[model samples]
Every structure is written in structure tokens, then in C-alpha cells.
Target: MNYRTHIVSDLSEIGQAGWDGLVRAQDKPNPFLSYAFLHALHESGSAAPQTGWQPQYLVLFDGEELAAALPLYVKDHSYGEYVFDWAWADAYQRHGLDYYPKLLSAIPFTPVSGPRLMARDAHARAALVDVLVATQQATEVSSTHLLFPPEEQARQLKEAGFLLRSGVQFHWLNGGYANFEEFLATLEQKKRKNIRAERRKVAQAGVTLRRVRGREATHADWVLFNRCYRNTYRAHHSTPYLNLDFFERIGRDMPDNILLVIAEREGRPIAASLVIHDETTLYGRYWGELEHVPCLHFEAAYYQPLEFCIEQKIAVFEGGAQGEHKMARGFLPTRTWSAHWLAHPSFADAVERFLERESGGIDDYLDELNERTPFRK
Candidate 1:
């Protein structure tokens, strides 16, 4: 089969249907990988050249039909990426090498792991890998990295000679739970009691949570959610990667997949959490509060989403990125993977060695976390 590669600077060229069709064909289609989500990031200027996330999407076609694609970027820095490669960048700088403009295949500001190399078949997937490596070689970029891919895709990338890196994220899995209470029942008494106490604290503060589905959400609701989203970045002394336009776009384009958990005190919305989900999994992505309320974060971010997941029969709830605190609420440590290829041979070898050591430590960490599971034996 003859394959052709195309570097698309704008996603509009591929169109939503063509892009989302490939995504839907995946075994586990994530909302973040949907065309609406990625296009929102690009069109809203959230992930654009000005923001250091210049789109360099890779598309592979077999004759006239699209076979595989990757949501790639030419990154100027590593701020939004959760994989943490600042040290690698520093080492490059120390050696008078450039790390900026590295190729990254990832969903901007979304750390949830899913499929990265979207393909129709295994052969196309392997061909896409070849195209990715070839593109990196042809470009002046220092490296190419695929972040938060599924374990199966990560393995394929490793077989293609990409270095593998391991990281951990917390995810809550449904065990045929009939309801939130049933889920809690599976947890140890102490942990269940702690969760109950936390929920009670939010209630005692008179903060009632109201879940607004994206279709039901209004312009005012988007305004409030964006405010809270910005406040989260402000609290961290960092600028937000997303803007109001991005949120509004996604809300309009993919309403059914979006969930806005709003916390109201005295009938005024004070806190909100934005969650995105497909049929199988709910992803807790962003959360913030305008007013300080005890345990409000936990209620808005974890419990509400967990309850929704149980009600919707969603199989998994990924708590997003790092947070040992999620464990108390029944989230277990799950391994996440990324694949890397360095243009420089020495740097590539060094990163491979570092990943080996990091992988060992990650294994030990997962073991330690498993020993402290909140669920009852």
C-alpha cells in the first residue's frame, strides 16, 4: 500500500467530519480527541503560533482515503505539557542546543491519556510512525514526542524506536456500581467516612452543586465558568492556556459531552468544574471557585463527577494529571505513557537512560500507592 504524508497547519483543511471519523473508529474515543475540541483550541487562539503551540498536524493517506493522523504541534516551550521535560530542555540549553520548536503530538492542556496515533488499521498506524520520524528528520526540530497515548500505541511507538516514558494519573473505575453510595460501600469504612465528611462540609457551607449539561448551559454560565477557569491560573501565578471563546465553542459544538458542575451559595454560583466525557468515561479537566468554601473543591471536582459517572454508567472517571488527594475518593493510580524521539543521538541516548531510571521509580511508586487503596479488601 502506497502512503502519502501531509503536514496540515490548520485543522479546518481536514474538516471536522474527516477528523472525527478517524477518532470515532478508535476502540476508546476520548472527547478531547474530537475535532471540535482540537479545533476550538486552535481557532480560539488557545493553542496557536502566538501561544507557542503552533499546529503542525500530521496526516497520512492511502491513495485518496485518510488512513492515519496525529494532532501535532511545534512547541516553543513545555508549560502546558504535564510530562515535565524542563530538565531535558535545560540540558539542551546548557549544551548550546535548541529544544524549542520540538514536535509534540498531544491534546493541549489536556493530560488525560487516550489514542494519539489515530489510524484505520495497524499497518497504517505503523506507517504513520514512519512518517512522524521522517518529518522530524526532515525538519530542524530537536525532537518529536507523543504524549499520553494509550499503552498499546505507546508500545507500537517503542517498537518504532521511540523512547518510552511512564507517568501516573489517578482514575476511578466503576465496578458495576448501582449508585454513588454503592461505590462508597466498596471503600474501607475510614475512607468512606472521610468522603462523607468532606461532602458534608460543602453542604454545611450551604454550597449546593447543580450540574448543567452543555446543551442546557447559557452564555452567562460560560462567563462564570471562564471566570473560575481563569482564577485557577491566577492562583497559580500563571496564564490560562484556554480562553472564554474556546470554552464557548466547545460548549456549542459538543454540548452533550460537556458537564458543568456549578456550586451555588445563597443561590449565587461561586464555584464550577468543567468535565468532558464520552459514553464510556468522564474526564475531570478544570475546576475553580470564586469564594473559598471548605471542601468545595472536592465536592465540585470529584464527588459530583463521580456521582454523574455512576448515574450515567460511565466506566471510568479520570481525575486528570497528578493528585494523591484523589485516592481518598477512590481514585487508583493508573500508568500513563509518552513516546519520545530526539534528533540528537547523544541526547536521545541520555533521555533513554533517564527514562529507564524513571520507569523503575514509577513502578515502585505505583506499588506504594496500590498498598494504600481506599477500597475494602
Candidate 2:
């Protein structure tokens, strides 16, 4: 099979229909990899060159048919990517080297693990790995990083000479429970009791919660969510990577895949959590509040979304990034994978040794987390 590669700066270069067709063909089709979600990231300027997420998407064409593509980015700074590489950048600076213009492959502002390489078949997938390595060598970049790829894809990256790095995220798996209560019943009594108490705290505070599907969400609802989203970032003394335009674009383009869990006081919205879902999984993305109700964050962000997952028969709910606290709420620690390739030989050797040590730490961490399982044994 003759394969051609095009390093595009825009999704319009390949168009939605073609790109989406390949995403759907993958063994695991996810909403984050969809054209609707990614195109919105760039088109809304949330993940564009201006913000340091310059698109360098690699598309493989087999005689005019879009065979596969990787959502690549040229990042000047690492703000939205949850994978911590600041130490690597600092090390480069200490050596009087530059690391700002590194290459990254990930969904902007989302830490959920899913497909990064949206390929139609093994042939194209293999071709993509080769093209990416060749592209890395030809470019004047410090490193190329692939964050939150599946375990299989990470292994393939390893065979292609990329170093594999492991991390952990909390996720809730369905046990075929008929409802929320039934699901809660599987947890240890202490955990179950604590969760009940937390939910009650929100209710006793006179906060009422409701969910709004994207199609049914009003502009006012989005405005409220953006406020809450920005507030969360502000509280941490940081700027939000996404804006209202980005949320509204995803809402407009992929309404069926979105759900907003909002909390109200006296029929007025005060807090909200945004989650994205498909038939298989629900990804907890963002959340914030105007007033601090005890445990309101868990209610809006975790409990409500967990209930929605059970009701919809969704197989998994990724609780997003790092949160050991999520374990008490019935989430279990799950392993996430990323691959890295440093351009400098000395730096590459150093990182490879560092990753070796980091990998061992992650193994012990997972074992410890398993020993403290929240579920009844």
C-alpha cells in the first residue's frame, strides 16, 4: 500500500467527514478524537498557534482516501497538557538549551485517556509512527510527546524507539447496576456512608442539582458554566485555557455528546460541571462554583455524573487527571500511558533513565492503591 503524508495546520485541510470516518473506524471510537471536538479546539482559537497549541496534524492518504491521522501540535508552553514536563524544560534551560518549541500530541485541556492516533487499520497506523519519527528528526524541535495514548499504541510507540511513561487516573466501571443506589451498594460501608453524607451536605445547604443535555442547554446555561469554569481556575490563580466560544462551539457541533450538571439555589444557577460522553464512556472535564457548599464539588462533579453514567448504561466514567480522593467516591485507580522522544541524544538518554525510575514508582503506587480498594472484597 502506497502511503502519503500531509502535515496540515488546519482540520479544513482534510475536512470533517473524512477525518470522522477514520475516527469511527478505530477499535475504540471516542468523542475527544472526533472531528467535531478537535476542529472546535482550533477553530475557536482555544488550541491555536496564538495560544501555543499550533496544529501540525499528520494525515495519511492512500491514493486520495484519508487512511489515518494524528492530532499533533507544536506547543511553545505546556499549560493544558496534564503530563508534567516542566522539570525536563528546566533541565534544558539549566544546560542553556531551548525546550519551548517542543512537539506534542494530545487533546487540548482534556486529560481523559483515549485514541490519539485515529487510524483505519494497522498498515496506516504503522505508517503514521514512521512518519512521526521522520518528522521529528527533520524538524528543529527539542522533543515530541504523545500524551494519554492507549497501552497498545504506547507499545507500538516503544517499538518505534519512543520511551513509554505511565501515570494514573481514577475511573468508575459499571457493574451492571440498575441505578445509583445499587452501584453504591458495591462499595465498602465506610465509603458508602461518607458519599451519602457528602450528598446530604449539598442538599442541606439548599442547593438543588439538575442536568442539562447540550441540545437542551440555553445560552444562559453556557454563560453560567463559563463563569464557574473560569472561577475554578481563578481560585488557583491561573487563567483558563478554554473560553466561552470554545464551549459554545462544542455544544453546537456535538450536542448529543455533552452533559452539564448544574446546581441551583432558589432556582438560580450557582455551580456547574461539564462532562462529555458517548455510548461507552463519560469524561469529567470541568467544574466550578460561585458559593462554597460543603461537598458541592463532589455532588456536581462526581456523584451526579456517576448517576448519569449508570442511568445511561455507560461502561466507564473517567474521573479525569489525578485525584486520590475520587477513590472514596467509588472510583478506582487506572493506568494511563504516554510516549516521549527527545531529539538531543544526551537529553534522550537522561530522560530514558528518569522514566525507568518513574515507571517503578508508578507500579508501587498502583499496588498501594489496589490494597486500599474502596469496594467490598
Candidate 3:
């Protein structure tokens, strides 16, 4: 098949329908890969050249029909990408090398694992991989990285000579439970009791949660959600990567995919957690609170989503990124992967070696996490 690659600075150039059509054709379609979610990141100014994430979205065309696409970026820093490469960047700096402006294909600020390459078939996918390497070589970027790609794509990337790095995230898998209590019954006695205690504490504090869908959420709800979202970053003394406009865009464009769990006390909202979902999985994305209510975070961020997943028959609830605490709430450790290719041959070789050792450590860590699973045998 003959394919031509076009690198555009904006997603709108490819148009939502065209881009999303390719995404849906993939084996695993995710909301994060949706045109609205990604375009919102750029159009809302949350991710752009000024913010160190310059869009360099790659699209492949077979005579004007969009064959494949990658949500690529020219990253000047590694802040939002959950896959930590700061040590690699530091090694580059020490050797008088530049790592900034590296090519990255990922959902900005989202650590949830999903498809990074949206292609129709194996032929198109293979062609897309070649285009990625050629783009890195042609642009002369220090390296290219694909974060949170599915396991199959990781294999293709490996075959294409990209180094594979492994990480872990906790996710709750539905076991055909009829309700939240039935799900809890699968957990060990201690973990099950602890979870009950936590929920009881929230209830005793007079904090009630209301799950609001995107379309049902009012403007005031979004404003408060944004405030809570910003407060989360502020508490850590870091700047927020997303803004109100981005949330509003997703709410309007993909209303069915958005769920806001609002925590209220005395009939006044004090906290919020935002979840994004597709037909199969619910993703716990962002959360914050105006008042410190004990166990509120777990309730809004974990349990509520877990209940929603069971009620809606969603297969998985990804607890997001790193959190050992999530294990106590029935989330089990799951492996996530990323692929990399450094332009410098020597450095690439070094990273390959490092990844081999790191891969073993991740394996051992996953083993340990599994041994400590909160669920009953």
C-alpha cells in the first residue's frame, strides 16, 4: 500500500470525523484517543507550543483518505507525561546533549494506557511505524517516545527497534458483580471492612456524593470543578496543565463520556472528581476538594467509579497512575508500557540496557503487588 505522511500542527486540519474514524477502527478504542479530548488539549491552550507541548500530529493518507494517525507532540519537557524520563534527559544534559523537543505520542497529563497508533490494519500500522521513525530522523529530534501504547503495538514498536519500558497502574476489573456489595464480598475480610469504615466516615461527616453526567452538569458545577482541579495542583505547589475551557469542550463534545462525582456537605458542593469513560472502561482522571473531608478522596475517586462501573456494566475502572492505597479498595496492579527510540546510537544502546534491567525490577514489583492483592483467593 502506498502511503504519504503529513505532519500538521493542529488536529482540526484532519477534522474530528476523519481522525476519530481511524481511532474507532483500532482494536482498543479509548475516549482519551477521541478527537474531542485531544483537540481540547490543544485548542484550550492546555497543551501547545507555548506550554512545551507543540503539536506535531502525524497523519497518513492513501490518496486523500486518512489511513492512520498518531497524536504526536514535540515536547520541550517531560512534566505532563506520566512516564518519567527526567533521568534520561539529565544524562543527555551531562553529555552536552539536548533532550528537549523530543517527539512524544501520548495523551497529555493522562496516564491511562490505551492505543497510541490509530490505524486500520496491520499494513497501515506498519507503515505508521516507519513514518514515525522517518519523522524523527527527518526532524533530527533527539528521540521519539510513545507512552501508554497497548501491548500489541508495543510488540510492533519493539520489532521496529524501539526500546520498551514497563510501568504499573492499579485498575479494578469487574467480575460480573450485581452490585457494590457483591464486589466488596470478593475482597478479603480486612480490606472489605476497611472500605466500609471509610465510607461510613464520609457518611458520618455529612458529605454526600452526587454523580452528575456531563450534559446534566450545570455551569456552576464546572466552575466549582475547575476550582477543585486547580486547588489540587496548588496544594502541590505546581501549575495545572488543564483549564476550564478544556473541560467545557469535552463536556459539550463528548457528554456521554464524562462523569462528575460531586461531594457535597450541607447541600453545598465542596469537592469533585472527573471520570472519563467509553463503553468498556471508566477512567478516574482528576479530583480535588475545597474542604478536607476524611476518606472523601477515596469515595469520590475510587468507590463511586467502581459502583458506576458495576451499575453500568463497565468492564474496568482504571484508578490512574501510581497509588498503592488504591489496592486496599480492590484495585489490582496492572502493567503499562511505553516505547522509545533515541537518535544517538550510543545513548539508545545505553537506554536499551537500562530498560532490560528496569523491566526485571518492574516484573518483581508486580509480583510483590500481586501477592498483596486485597481480594480473597
Clashes of each: 0, 0, 0
Write down the TM-score of every candidate.
Answer: 0.98, 0.98, 0.98
lDDT of each candidate versus the true structure:
0.91, 0.92, 0.91
Please report how far candidate 1 places residue 369 from its true position, in Å.
Answer: 1.2
Residue range 116-162, candidate 1, lDDT tens digits = 99999989988888888788889999998899999999999888889
Candidate 1 Cα errors over 4 Å, as ranges? none
**Candidate 3 TM-score, true structure as reference:** 0.98
Instruction: List candidate 2 segments past 4 Å from native.
Output: none
Candidate 3: segments with Cα more than 4 A from true spot: none
Cand. 2 Cα-lDDT: 0.92
Worst 10 residues of 1 by lDDT: 57-66
User: Candidate 3's error at 152, in angstroms?
Assistant: 1.2
Candidate 3 lDDT tens digits, 1-377:
78988999998898888888888888878898888998999999999888999998888999988998888999889999999999999999999999887999999999978788888887888899998887888886899999999998999999988999999998889998999999999999999999999999999999999999888988888899999999988998999999999989999999999999999999898999999998899999999888889899999988898899999999989989999988989888999999999989999999999999999999999999989979898
Model 1 TM-score, all chains together: 0.98
RMSD of each: 1.1, 0.9, 1.0
Preferred candidate (TM-score higher): 1 or 2: 2
